[model samples]
Target: MRFMVMVKATGYFEAGIRAGKEHSAAKDAFLHDLQDAGVFQSAEELLPSSSGLRVVFPPGGGAPAMQAGPFLPEQEWIADYTVIDVDTEDEALKWVLRMPLPPGQGEHVIEVRRLASGTACALDARAQTMKADLQDQLSLLHP
Candidate 1:
């Protein structure tokens, strides 16, 4: 099963940067262990909400508009994530449960989903179409 484990940030996470270095070392080591176990596919830590952008399209045919950070109804902050491929949902959850978080600081949200292998015919057709498109683009660029 493939699971996208999301680490929800709390106030303490920001506080940690100011609080000191106790949890930082443990957090880094825990991430390393996950990589060593061959269970870690990818991980990324996001910036504060104020740095994000929200894009929305107009009701008619107007172009999309972008708004700067901190959208309304502030809820749980998404801090980081780890995508892991495990044996089962249970296993994925187990892995997520073991992830280290700033002590009493943040919430860990684990979303597990069974990976799907799409129809071979569909994939093959898409690949062929992409190849044709790429060739056309290359010809246009070169010619």
Candidate 2:
């Protein structure tokens, strides 16, 4: 099973306070361990929501509306994410429990969600094709 583990954002993170060396080291070590165990697939830390935007589709079917960010209610933002291939939800939970706490001494939340896999449905196939086309376009730009 594949799981997406998301580290929730806090007020401190929204303010752009980066992880301290100790916290970074701890996280690096933990990720290294997961990699060594062949469980880690990918991981990344996201920039604050201030650098992002939101596209909301209206129910009445006009056009998607864009909302610039510096979005409030910090709890709604995600700080980072990790993708891991694990045997079971219990295993994923165990790995999540092993993650280091965020720099400041306060409450933190991590969400783990299973990723869908196997044979693609019609919508999935369309999405996959779109993703491949986008990747090809990106390669042209970068390469």
Candidate 3:
């Protein structure tokens, strides 16, 4: 199974400066361990929304408006994320729970969600056969 683990930010724009060094070190170490485990496929720490772009449509059929910067509430910020492949959702959740948060922060919230399945790989029979073989291998390995 594959899961996307989201770490939500409580507040931001220099929030980390307030969190002490111990917190930073712990988080770094945990990330390192995750990578070392071979479970990590990809991971990235997000910049505060202030650095992004947002396009909003006008009330009518006029051209859509464009704007940038911190567009929403601070509570919506995501601290970081990791995409992991594991045996099951349960195992993925356990991995997410092990990640550490910055010091003085509230409980680090990690959202683990399963990746979608049952998508056709291609229109060709070879592709279909390959997908079936892969699925069968996974089932046998996990079971």
Q: Best candidate, TM-score-wise? A: 2
TM-score of 1: 0.64
Task: Tell me the tens digit of each residue's lDDT in model 1 across 38-113.
Answer: 7766678787666778788888779999988664435566777777767777888777667766555435454455
Query: Which residue pairs collide in model 2, if any?
Result: none
The digit string of per-residue lDDT tens for model 3 on 1-143 reads 66789887666332434456786788778778877886776778777677777888988679998888675664466767887778988888788778776655555567778777644232346667898999999999999
How many backbone clashes can be found in candidate 3?
1
Q: Give me candidate 3's TM-score against the actual structure.
A: 0.65
Report the C-alpha displacement of residue 38, candidate 3, in angstroms.
Answer: 1.8
Query: Residue-pair clashes per candidate, as listed?
Result: 0, 0, 1
Model 3: clashing residue pairs? 50-70
Residue range 16-50, candidate 2, lDDT tens digits: 98768899999999999999999987889998899
| Model 1, total clashes | 0
Distance from true location, Cα of 126 in model 2, Å: 24
Q: Residue 89: error of model 2 in Å?
A: 0.1
Residue 113: error of model 3 in Å?
A: 1.9
TM-score quality measure for candidate 2: 0.80
- lDDT score of residue 39 within candidate 2: 91
> Cα lDDT of model 3 overall?
0.72
